[model samples]
Target: MVLCELKQQLDELLALSDGYAYCNQEVGRLACVQGQQEAELTALHTSIEAQNQKLLASTLARVQKEGAIRKGLEQHQQKLVAQDGQAEVLKQQLAASNLARESLSTTVTTALKKLALATSTQAQRVDSVEERLASLVERQRECEVQPPPGWATYLERNAVSLVALAVAVFTLGLNLLG
Candidate 1:
């Protein structure tokens, strides 16, 4: 009976050892799973950080580009403003020049009218003087052709007076022409 009891006790010990071995195997497998999960979590964090860096860099670059565009637009606007001012000045200058030209043209027209009137008056005066001179010459010729009985002595005495009269008429005509 003692031998049978000892055999039964040995069988119980073997069973307990088998259970402990199984528990240890399960613990080792669970540790391996935990390590794999940690590695996956670390890789996921690294990927997220890389994406965030790319996004930040792109955002910065975009902001710089927008700022440059805004600055260029401002400069262009300034240039347009300056050009507008210059155009206004040019418009004013053009208006002044037109007014001056009109005034000058009016002056020239008035001067031309006065000159034409003076020329017409002068021409009439010259014609009247020429007609008077021609009549005097005709009278002198008629008197010379038919002298009366005392005409010879009278002509000799009045010859100097007649010559003076002719010279005066010629001088008067020249003065009028000038």
Candidate 2:
């Protein structure tokens, strides 16, 4: 009975040792799995950071391009505004030119009317003077044989003065026409 008791205790001690060794092997396997998980997590973090940097760069480029486009649009708007101002000024100038042209045309028309009236008056005067000259010539021929009457001599002198006056009027009319 004593030998059997010793054999049983030895068997129990051997079984406990085997259980402890299995527990240690399980702990080592779990630690290896934890290490693999940590490496994968670190790789994922690095990938996320790289993607974030690329996204940030793309956003910055987009913002810069948008700003440039906005600035160009503003400049174009300013130019359009300036051109509108110039167009307004040109319109005003055109209106002023039209007014001036109308005024000048009215003045020219009035002057032409006065000139026509004056020309008609001058032509009538010239025709009356020519008739008087023809009558004076007929009277001079009729009195040629009657000779030295005092009235006849005075009438010849008056006829010479009238001829000079008619020549002066003709020269003035020519000057006005030219």
Candidate 3:
């Protein structure tokens, strides 16, 4: 009975030793798997950090471009305002020029009318003077064609006096014109 008890104790000790060895092997396999998972997580973190840096750089560039576009729009708006002011000034000048042109046209029309009226009056005066000259010439021709009975004796005795009278009549005509 004492030998049977010692053999049973030896069997129990061998079974415990086998269980400890199996547990140690399982722990080592789990540790290797954990190490592999940790290495993959580190690689993923590195990729995420690089992507974030790229995104930050892209955002900064976009912001700068937006600021430049806004400044350009503001400058263009200011130029448009200045051009609008110039257009208004040009419109006013055009209006003033139109008014001046109308005034000049009116003045010219009035002057032309007065000139036509004066020309008509001068033509009528010339016609009257010409008719009077015709009548005087007719009278002088009649005088030359017929002489009175006493005229021949008077002309023969006063030829110089007749010449002087003719000169006096011509001088009177010039004085009347003045």
Q: RMSD for all candidates, in order, please.
A: 73.7, 72.7, 74.0
Q: Model 2 off-target regions past 4 Å?
A: 1-4, 83-178
TM-score of 2: 0.41
Q: Write one digit per residue (lDDT tens) for candidate 1, span 1-178.
A: 4346445655655565575566556555655655665576567557656755665575567557556655655565566567875555555545665565566556556755755675576566556655655665565555446433244544475577657767878999999999
By TM-score, rank the candidates, best first: 3, 2, 1
Per-residue lDDT of model 2, residues 26-111, tens digit only: 55565565566557656755765675566557556755755665565556556666787555555554566556556755655675
Q: Give residue 57's error in model 2 in angstroms.
A: 0.6
Candidate 1 displacement at residue 156 in angstroms: 99
Each prediction's TM-score against the native? 0.39, 0.41, 0.42
Candidate 3 lDDT over residue span 2-73, tens digit each: 346445645655565565555556555655655665575567557656755665575567557556655655
Model 2, position 26, has a per-residue lDDT of: 56
Q: How displaced is residue 77 in candidate 2, in Å? A: 2.0
Please give the clash total of every predicted structure, in order: 0, 0, 0
lDDT of 2: 0.59
Residue 5 shift from truth in candidate 3, angstroms: 3.2
